[model samples]
Target chain A: MTLEILAFALAALLMLGGAAVVALTKDLMRLVVGLGAFLLGVAGMFLYYGHAFLATAQVFVYVGGVLVLVVFAVMVVHRANGGRPLVTSQHDIGAAAVAFGVSGMLVMSLRESVGGWLPESGTSGSSIAQELLGGHLVAFELLGVLLLVALVAVLLIVGPGERR
Target chain B: MTLLWGFLWGVAAVATIAGGAILGVWWERKVSARIQMRYGPQQIGPFGSLQMIADVPKLLFKEDIVPALADKAIFKYAPLFVFGPVAVSMVVIPFTAGWAPLNTSVGVLFFLAVPSIEVIAILLSAWASHNTLSTLGGLRATAQMISYEVPRSLAVLAIVLLAGSLRPLDVVAAWRWWWMPLTFVAFVIYFVASIAEMNRGPFDIPEAESELVAGYFADYSGMRWASFMMAEYGAMIAASLFGAALFFGGGWPFGGALGVITLIVKAILIMTAIMWVKWTFPRLRQDQLMSFCWKALTPLALVQLVVVGVVLVWL
Candidate 1:
């Protein structure tokens, strides 16, 4: 249990560091790298939670898909732009302080709440499946619909936009 | 027991990486040669089995060039970023019952996620190179992966619904009794999406050799290039393993140790089939690849997902 806590703490620190980099960096490419690192750290956290599945999914989807998209978009838009040193505005500092403060408070509250709650005994793979299928059936169905809508939207956007 | 399991798994992962890399390279060359109407590496040992081994040293010794304008730190770390996740993903892939290294409840999810991280490596490599062609290739790859990933995830969701568990072993067990039509559709979608996800032909627009001049890795050489190769082949092997576990019923032909062997065999067979497809088909244009994913595959996967959900809940 102590080892698990240490792992979680390490992952959280890495994630927070990445987030700080993303917030502070002026370079667009560096920001993307920071985001990737943040997502990777999140994946490590997921692994600590005994959800290796979620960790991998987080790595594959956010890091692999979204971050890559962001990088590519930056590359395309900034093709001609090169060697321009990134400049951070003073407003960003104020925004960062607010973000950090709110998150810190939330984390503190969560820690207190977690301390009061009784830990659930080992929920095996079978139990999780049962819960997903039997209890969370509505949410499961909705996810399918949501995915379908997203697919249609993507097609309509990408397909006609190019042709037009 | 955990330590013993870890040791075994480590050995399996290494062997899988080494074997898959060697075999995949040889197979790719032979296929490419046949496609070009020439015998490939026949001079090397036994149908060029040793051809890939000979090329490794050459690749290792080649100059590793860092473009003058590139981000030095990210550029240096990108290859490790690409290679690490692919190796780590091997843990959740169950070769047989009681064989997986990290036998967690979320095996399928874990398997699905590793390849996603690989895209980041490509994106970073491109950005770090600071070259137009590399950046363009990276953009193409990013778009390709994102468009295809939705369908890939949805298809896997359908399988998860049917299998009733995310564990690779459970997925195989669920498929033993009957091959449902929805499962078959899910399998087809998963297979195609996986191929695209791995950036293989005909969806290999990201690394279009002719147009992009080796695409994102145009500036990369030596061990850096080799790392990319390993990641790609690793993904191929990983996807094959996932496919086998999900659709073909992993480790079904035998029990115990032999079961693991059977799973490996299935994965290799699937890899070869992918290679065959790679060699046979012309590469798709970027637009066509995106359309195939968003327009064709995604809707199909969604339908399968709903069908599977309904079957599971109501029927």
Candidate 2:
């Protein structure tokens, strides 16, 4: 029980710290890295909750796919050069107030709903297959089509152009 | 006790990779040397097996350079990101009958997914290096790795489909004599895709020595640079081990202590074949490599999946 709690706390800290980095940092690259950290923390949360499949999927998909693209964009598009941070945030009173209010609401809501929510350990991999292919089959296949469309669009955009 | 055992096994896994990497490098040099008509590394050990012992220290103790423009933290730490996943992957390979060191039910996914993390590591190192050649190398490597992953996963999909479980133990548990000739195409696809994934010759456009000048690790020096080599060899070993279990009957013909030996011997044969192919084949051009992965390998992998499905259904 203690170990699980400690693990949960560490994962929460990672998510919070990563969020803080994304919120506070000026460097675009670091912001993407912060996002990666936040995603990994979410994976950690899934891991400690006995959903190893979900945790692995989280790492495999988000961290592996989206994080790479975002990082690549931050590097190439911004030309983030020689340690001078890109993607600077404008300091504003309104943004800070909104952030604080949002976090406060989250805390209050979580505190209220924290009881009787945790699942017992050890879900099988078949459950994931059933959930994705059985119950969510339409959504899953649609996602495939969506990604295929995006791929074709990108290829058409990049393909057989007059040399840039 | 389980946690302690996990810790110890993790340590053992890393140690195995490190030790295997030493022999791997030496053997690669010797093999390449023989292919090129020369004696290699004869001074260190009987067959120059210990040559890496002398070489690793030289690399490690040499001045570790961080280019002036490099991102200090990311540049310094990228090797760990690169090396760590490859090491963790070794845990799931079934070296004994009906068992692996870490026998998670998601063993197969663990094998595939965890190594994808190295893409981030490679990119980070590339971005951090801040050198144009290194950046170009990094971009090529990232593209190549990501592209090759499609076919690799698809190739492995056939094995998982046939085994009916993702666990390495289950995969090996269900391995039969006929599956060898049956899954040969999948094995070849897996083999070719894996070689590409590891950035080896014929597919090694990333670090094409004549073009990119050591590729993404161009600015890395000494131990830092060696870490990338270690990662490469570690990945090769892990991939070879897993391929042995998936395609070849790992730990077969006997199921006890001898099974482990059989598995290792099979893995070593695969490793040797990999080296032979690396030494024998010429490197591909960047466009050629990309085209081959998309147009050739991925489709071939898909076809193999269908064929395997048919075979499994009927037979």
Candidate 3:
């Protein structure tokens, strides 16, 4: 029991520390590294919550996909040295304020709404696959279609002049 | 008790990686020498077997220099990022019955996913060095890994379809004679993708020495550089072991201690094959590598997956 508590506390600390690093870092690449660390820490917490599938999914999606995408985007516009500051500028202060305000509101609202609610035990991979293919097939197909449309839209917007 | 189990397995995995990397270095030199019709490592232990033993101290004692304009924090720590995930992935590789260090439910997925984390480390080293050549190498690596990962996962997905489980042990145990014809295609794809993923042989654009001047870790020195080599060899060994586990009947041919020995021998054979290819083939052009992944491998893997899925459903 004590071991479990210590593990949880350490995971929480890692997540918070990574978050702090991401928020405070001044280099673009360093910010991406912090984001990767933050994602990994969150994935560890998901494992602690007894959702090994969710934890692995979190790693696959965030660490593998989104992190790579974010890094590629940064690399595209990345300056060689310390030319670009990663910190929020004065002009972006309003955006930052709004972000914090919205997140705080979300936390408060969720706390009030689900005060006594407990999450169900994690679902098995097979069950989730069945749910996606059988019970929620329509929604799954819709999501795929939406992604396809988004891909086409991006290509149309960013493709060579001939297609446009 | 579980703690002891985990610790013991961890120690064993570390020792395997350390010993494997040292031996792999010497073996690769010998293989390359034999290909070139020259004696290699003849002066070291016996047939230059102790060359790696000599090289380790040389690298360890050399000056660890940091670039004047480098990002000190990332430069100092990036090698850990490269080596750590590879080491962690070793835990999921089931060498024998009931012997995998950490056998999670999603074993194969978790095993494959863990090693992708090394991409960020390579990127950090390239960017932190503030060298254009290293940056180019890093970008090439990131591109190659991302491109090849799709077909790689799809090939494994095909195997998972036939096996109907993500557990490494299950995958190996599910192998049957009839499943061979289809999985043969997948096995080839997996082997090729694993080679590319480890950044070796024909796919080794990131570290193409003549062009990129040692690629992403060009600026690294001493033990730091050695760490990168260790990580590379470690990943290679892990991938070979995984390929053995997934498709080659794993440790089932012989039971007990012999089973373990069989699995290790299979992995070593695969590693030797990789080394053979590495020395024999010229590196692909960057554009050619990308096209091969996207145009050739991805489509073929997807088609193979569809066939496996269809067969599994109807037959």
Fnat of each candidate: 0.77, 0.42, 0.33
A61-154: candidate 2 lDDT, tens digit per residue:
8888778877666656545355555764576678889989999999999988866542333377787677678767998999999999999998
TM-score of 2: 0.92
**Second chain TM-score per prediction?**
0.93, 0.97, 0.95
Query: Would you list the C-alpha lDDT of every candidate in the order shown?
Result: 0.79, 0.85, 0.83
The Cα error of candidate 2 at residue B196, in Å, is: 1.2
lDDT of 3 at A35: 86
Candidate 2 clash pair list = none
- Per-residue lDDT tens digits for candidate 3, residues B181-216, read 877788788888888988888888999999989999
Write model 1 residue lDDT over B184-205, tens digit each, in one string: 8888888888888778888888
Clashes of each: 3, 0, 1
For model 1, residues A77-127, the per-residue Cα lDDT tens digits are 675237633646778778878988999999999988977452353245555
List, residue by residue over A125-163, the lDDT tens digit for candidate 3: 786677678777998999999999999998888788656
- Which 10-residue span in candidate 2 chain A carries the lowest summed lDDT? A114-123
* Over 4 Å off, model 2: A80-85, A91-122, A149-164
